[model samples]
Target chain A: MRQPMTALERVHVTEVGPRDGLQNEERVLTTAEKVALVRALVAAGVKEFELTSFVSPRAVPALADAAELVAELKDVEGIHFSALVPNLRGAERALEAGIDSIVLFVSASQSHNAKNVNRSVKESLRDFEQIARALEGSPIELRGAIATTFGCPFEGNVDVRAVGNIARHFADIGVRYVSLGDTTGMATPPLVSERIWHLREVASGIEPTLHFHNTRGIGLANVMQGLALGVDRFESSIGGLGGCPFAPGASGNIASEDLVYLLTEMGIDTGIDLPRLIEAAHVATRLMGRPLPAQVSKAGPRLALSDCSAVPTARG
Target chain B: MRQPMTALERVHVTEVGPRDGLQNEERVLTTAEKVALVRALVAAGVKEFELTSFVSPRAVPALADAAELVAELKDVEGIHFSALVPNLRGAERALEAGIDSIVLFVSASQSHNAKNVNRSVKESLRDFEQIARALEGSPIELRGAIATTFGCPFEGNVDVRAVGNIARHFADIGVRYVSLGDTTGMATPPLVSERIWHLREVASGIEPTLHFHNTRGIGLANVMQGLALGVDRFESSIGGLGGCPFAPGASGNIASEDLVYLLTEMGIDTGIDLPRLIEAAHVATRLMGRPLPAQVSKAGPRLALSDCSAVPTARG
Candidate 1:
């Protein structure tokens, strides 16, 4: 007799909405508002949070108050607070701000790297190696991000082998975790699976993470495909912020609340409180003075009939 | 030795954006505009198009001109034009309108069905059986639609077995095709796959279709999972119109242009011209006096590097 289908595994969600989301918005959020949003998300049981970036204020003005925000959020507990860093300088700043982890970004596409970080893939690899060596023996865990892994707005379709090679390089440099970004939101299911499969093969032991954009509206689709490949870690923005600045018309990252809702509805234990997360999205949307691009913000939770019937409503 | 991973089979895309799309829009489109939109979609090579719904004008006023629109486009060759029907009356209207294929909808949740069609599931199923008998030995192909298959806004989570039983009933009544609708956008990937699999088992030989709402932002993710389960047909609204009236906070269906773009990118043959479909979306948006919720309309196509490099301007 054939074996019965096994129960699906629960996936871990790493929410980057606050950091990646706010950084790409036209309006800059106050430090207090950002902290409140973060607190709301924490109350929703989001353990992995990308708090902010420590890049130059000139490059990302929205995140210029990163240091102050991190300092103020020092009291928040039971969460993994991380920050994005460009080089050793940014890493040092994040470390000084008492962040638990730091993320380092490099592009899989050479052209995208040049346009996004003003560096080629080879040059970025070199910088990453230096940064990794400098951060050795620190309490902070290092994560390598490979942007535009699936497709690039500037370069078009990126080679799976190229992404695999980059993942291998990160592994070789002693980085335990790496994130593959669909920077321009060009990844679909097959491309997502193929790229993740190749990266897993090349990295051998390092765990792979996914960073998807809903630009073309396939962010969650890509996430499902990644899950099929046993990838549980993901990077999502709250209210879908942090769109591509270089690619015109590209929207922000995938919405964290949306992703969490998906995972939870699948019977996967994401440890997130759906209603509270939606409330957090509202807080972020108010800060932006407009609707943030989260689907769940407009559409409430997908509740079972029993749950809906139990809740008494004035409209009903 | 482990078997090498088999590549996923190609998925089919049914573009219902024109018919199902306009039916839910507040703006009523003229017959000429509707024909132009359909013609543009045909030029873009959409094979299966849900042309219009033949429901009563009093019930769905937005689709009041369905017959006139169908009569005008009778000359279009090599495309399958299907119509939505409420009961035998709607089916007769569709047949009179020269549409040979019809999609019949019934909600899986009793409360949703009563709210949507003003009837319970048992009443709707009895009506469907009568309609199926009437269409027997005719050229008309009846497609049974189970709305709120994933989750009911009024109900919460729907039982998979309940959906399967509904599908079995439709199959036994000689419905050739069945579509499970995530009316409130509550479907996660696992839920989609589980429901589709169970429905397939219950329906035996009948092929399953999917109608997804992008309300929770997991529309494409649900589509991806459905595709993985060997589902070929999908219902999408152009510019993502046609939000569920019964399901509070539910957004529109998935955008047809965006779905086509995703399928074509994955090397799946959708026979859809992305640019031309986008043009059709623009026409629809103009008629609606607001942007339809299409991601591809706002964001351009995902191109290869060679394609992007050849383009003169970076941003479309």
Candidate 2:
């Protein structure tokens, strides 16, 4: 039987649209438009955000105004904002931005790491060590993410130990929240269960956050497995804003509205307003000038009724 | 924890592309093109199909050649073919075409039933009694479907007992297979479990075939709940080829390739050739002259590795 909603009543959702979603889009929103987007979601009661990334503007031109966007949003009350940082330089910039947290990332697959950052996995880990040392005793919290934790585009299947090693590294540095990224949407139920169990064995104190993409159309299904395992934290984008730069026509992040719909329908509490989230999704689609891949926004809330006389009827 | 794959290994998937999928489309397919589509799915190891509807051509012109399609596919070995029929006349046509079964449908909601067939639910059930009597002692199987089994478009939430009553009627008429149709994509995981449990108590002998739409993006998540409840049979369409004419912009059916991918990844057996299924999805898209909503077909298989030199890499 499926897990009763009583077992896991509350879940934490981190909206990643501003950073992970927009980073791959060709159309770049101005800093003000980005601020407006965040405000819309904040009105929907979204308090946790992967606000932006402190990567080189030359590398990801879509998010070139990351610091400017953060500066505009840093004073929002009762919100937890975390920014992705690649190295010591990015980490230092994030700390100076006065955000709530800094997320240091490394790819679990060596080939993906090299392709992503032009460095080997060993070098990335060494850089993370320096970044962790730099953030020591800072008020801003430190977290870690392992990309390509499920599968790699350049390589076929990533080893479990590769992900475990990164989690172990994060645990060693006193970081507690570790995110497993399905960078190319290769994560599945068995792989998710296996990885969570492996992390329990290797780094028992670390709380795993599942970040899945709807690339293969099983993103929410994977979330079901995560919920069944009692894992609650997840990451999604508004209107499913991101697509994989490596895999053309592949979706990047699961849509935030759809994720909330799934959790809310299951009777789980996320402290987010669904109608407001859907309203935010419309703002996102208007910002992009196209329909997004998120289904819930297009379909409306489950109870949004239709007029019988207005719709054509079919026999089958 | 998630159910292990070993417990309920083999799941049966019924392809409903020919009838339920195309009936809503504006473009009418020639009998040959329909035949080609069925052949493509057959090549992908699909053994069960809701092949066509024996409805009036004036009502649904897209599937006007129902008898012709059944005549074309009746000779295929080891295939189970079923057709949707609204009244005694359609049932007679389906029986004449030598189909394995005939599906009789009625909307669980009164307004939907009135809109769909211009009859009340009671009148529809009385009509089913006549059809059942007409097919008495015949070799063809009788199956029943209740549309709007989850939430009705006009009405908000459907009572579980309303669904149970329909199932009870189906079981009373010697119908062992009853399909719960999420006609407008109103199904959620909790609704699925509740309805299934209610059916078990009200109509214990009848097995449910879940027919879900991807309108809200949790179609596969609902399948996960069905699988958890040990319900093995499901229905999907190739390329997700249908849309609800009643609910504009909402998707009609879950894509077959995506469903098979989820099952295969979870190590559950659906006896499907995924690559071949993907090939069929491409054929479906070509036939429609547009991109469909299926994600896996657009994303490719999980192991379809990318060339490092040809693709762009992102830091996040």
Candidate 3:
């Protein structure tokens, strides 16, 4: 029953259900439900949790209580609770709430930046200078997330060099981990691989993690190539929840349970309790009053065929 | 827009919706609709198709028109239409119907065979002996499929050596191509890799194709590993149709359209037109009177980004 019993190499997972997933969902979970999920995730052996986002309530109402949520989980033991900050004000709120880690966002595509944050990519980087200076004396660990790094819906085929420049900006500010978000779930394996390679070549000091969506049904395949390329970290959402707030019925992130199944079966340690994580997904479904698109939650785990000697294949 | 524009590998896809998909669904299409699907598939550039199963109508009402369906498509030029044969009688019917390719099934796990066919594994092997002798020089290309080769839903954790033994048995019967069926969708990449290695070590002359179910959400991931293992042939259902007849509500085969998306993007030549394949999936949902769980069908094939100068990250 040990986590990573087979997966010898450790694979770090950042659970983003509370932030990325809930933000895109029409259902706004109460602070208590959100807290319950984050607590359950930590209990399920998650080491890192993107606990909340400190964006303006006007922008992402589901995460309106981001500061309060951060304050509540900031002291949770055995996990790194982090917050997503859209700008300097969000960063201030997260830092003031005593959060130890923060993830900043910038889109690799210029049009995405304008549409997503109402700023050009260059304008956001200029704003980053102020945000970076504000975090200079803060104890927070900063990470940069470049959304639409794989393929931008608006721009299409985002230039890999654009992603590197964003990574360079983060590296310049002493951020050690930068995530490439497949925001629209348009990432293919080759696209993911090429981006990671280009990022590594440019930001040799940063650790690259792939955030995938099962929107096109190859999220795990994209992760497989990422794993093959030696990516040690990934970001996924519980229950495969979330889609663009504007795009209803589109899938969110790769389900954490499905990702764990892939990693654990490959003898790569995720160190997460898969069944417990699935239980959390079930709870989310009950809370959301609908089934989220997490497949392992429905199919059960690889049949764990070891416990059976008597044939159940008749009704199976 | 050319296939194999970069991924030079030539991959063969067998569309199995009319057989594998329909058999597991509650709805049964009429003979004309079945013929229409076959014709549309042929028009969509499907060179190989599993059109029907020759089992008794009583056992599977979904495929009661097996004879008619096979006869309708058997002589379609530019396509090799095949049927599933459950026993000696089934094979006789298929051969008489002029279907030149037949897929014979047996379970690697004893209990699955018993539950699936009410026969023991050894008994099926004996049955194979008679079926093989009957098909000798009978204008048929015989391919053996070892179901539950990865894991058995009833028995769970089916021995890989047991699978190698089954492959060896097929090879002994003059069957040159054998497929390893993830009957319950329990395959992981490492298990797939190890099994392929073991199967090759034991049955060197036989070519292996991977049949995957996306029940646990890694169907395409499993296929990616199979491709990396150099398995060039695959069997998939359009709209991700077909589940184990016994495992209701469980996902059936991986969607052929989704598989084509992966291959075409990787620059591999599937020869099947991607858009046309998707249209066929749409036809399936329309005929089934419900949406099939095909992701790319919902996501719209990577946005083609060709029209983008300004990123349209808004609804994307």
Output the number of the TM-score-best candidate.
2
Q: Cα RMSDs of all predictions?
A: 5.0, 2.3, 3.8
The whole-model C-alpha lDDT of candidate 1 against the native structure comes to 0.75
Output the number of the DockQ-best candidate: 2
Candidate 2 per-residue C-alpha lDDT over B22-76 given as tens digits, one digit per residue, 9 for 90 to 100 = 8787677889998999999999999999988887787778877888889998668
Residue B153: error of model 2 in Å? 0.4
Give model 1's TM-score versus the native structure. Answer: 0.89
> Model 1, residue B211: what's the lDDT?
85
State the lDDT of candidate 1 residue by residue for A183-227, as single tens digits: 667777778777766776778767888888888888887787777
TM-score of each: 0.89, 0.96, 0.93
Model 3, stretches more than 4 Å misplaced?
A: A1-8, A244-249, A304-316, B1-8, B244-249, B304-316
Error of 2 at B189 (Å): 0.5
What's the candidate order when arranged by decreasing TM-score? 2, 3, 1
Note the DockQ of each predicted structure.
0.33, 0.52, 0.38
For residues B48-132, what per-residue lDDT tens digits would candidate 1 score against the true structure? 8877777667666667788888889889988888887877888888877788688888778888887677777888888889888
- Candidate 3 residues B209-263, lDDT tens each? 8888888888988888888778899999998887644443446789988899998
Inter-residue clash pairs, candidate 2: none
